[model samples]
Target: MASGADPKFEAELRRGVVQLVALDYLETPRYGYDLVRLLGAAGFPVEEGTLYPILRRFEKQGILSSRWDTEGARPRKYYELSAEGRAQKNAMLGAWAQVRDATDEALKRSMEAGQVGSPDGAEEETTS
Candidate 1:
C-alpha cells in the first residue's frame, strides 16, 4: 500500500480546486486544448473528458461565453469568462481562502495537541 494521504481524498481535494484554477484560466479567452496544455504545463494535468464538460456546463450556466474561430484550418471554440463568471470566481476564491485558513488552523491545533494520528481520532470530531 502507498503511504501518506489517501488517493481518493487527494483526488477529491484536487477536484474542488480545479474549478477555481479553471475559472482563473478562463479570465482570458482560450480553447479546450489550450487549457489542457496550459494547465499541464502548470503541473495541473487536466483530462479532456474532465475539462470539456466543465466548459460546457459553465457556458450553459451563462458563466462563460464561447465563440467559434473558423479562420484556422479547423474551426475551434474559445471560452472566456462572462461578467457573472468573474464575480463568481472572485467569490469562490474568497471562500477558498477561508476554507484553507480554517484547515491550516485545525491542522496546527492538532499538531500542537499531539492529536494528529491519535487512536481516538474520532473523539476530536466536531460539528461546525
Candidate 2:
C-alpha cells in the first residue's frame, strides 16, 4: 500500500485471506498469544477477540481442535488442525493456487492488451 491506498479494500482483502493464513499457521499447535504474535509477524495481524471466535467456529465445524497444555506457568488452550482440517487445508491451498494462476493470467492479458473495464479486455463503446 502506498500513501493513498483504500482502507476499506485493504480490510476486505485481509478478511478474505485470514482463514487461509490462520489455517496455514495452525499446522502446529499454538496457543492464543503465540498465534497472534506469529500471525502479526507474518503480516496477518489479528486480535485475540477475532482469533478466539474463529477458533471456536472452526472447532465447532470440526476443522480444528484444542486442548489445555498445563506444562507451562498457566494452562493455555492450544489449537491445531484436525484430520479434517488437514484435508481442508490442502484443498484450500490447491484452490488458492488455481485462483492465483487464473488472476495472473488475467492480469497478464490486461497488461498485454492494455485494456480495462471487462474480462473481454476491450474498451467500452461510446454513446452518441
Each candidate's root-mean-square deviation in Å?
Answer: 4.9, 4.0
Model 1 quality (TM-score): 0.84
Model 2, span 4-79: residue lDDT tens: 6697787776775788899989999988889899888887887888888888998999999999989989999999
Question: What are the per-residue Cα lDDT tens digits for candidate 1 across 54-101?
Answer: 889999999999999999998999999999999999999999999999
Residue 35 lDDT, candidate 2, scale 0-100: 88
Q: Give me the overall lDDT of model 2.
A: 0.84
Q: What TM-score do all the candidates reach, one by one?
A: 0.84, 0.82
Cα displacement (angstroms), candidate 1, residue 34, comes to: 0.6
Candidate 1 lDDT trough over 10 residues, lowest sum? 116-125
- Can you tell me which runs of candidate 2 are displaced by over 4 Å? 1-4, 115-128
- Candidate 1 ranges beyond 4 A from true positions: 1-4, 115-128
- Give the Å shift of residue 99 in candidate 1: 0.7
Please give the distance, in angstroms, between residue 88's alpha carbon in candidate 2 and its true position after superposition. Answer: 0.4
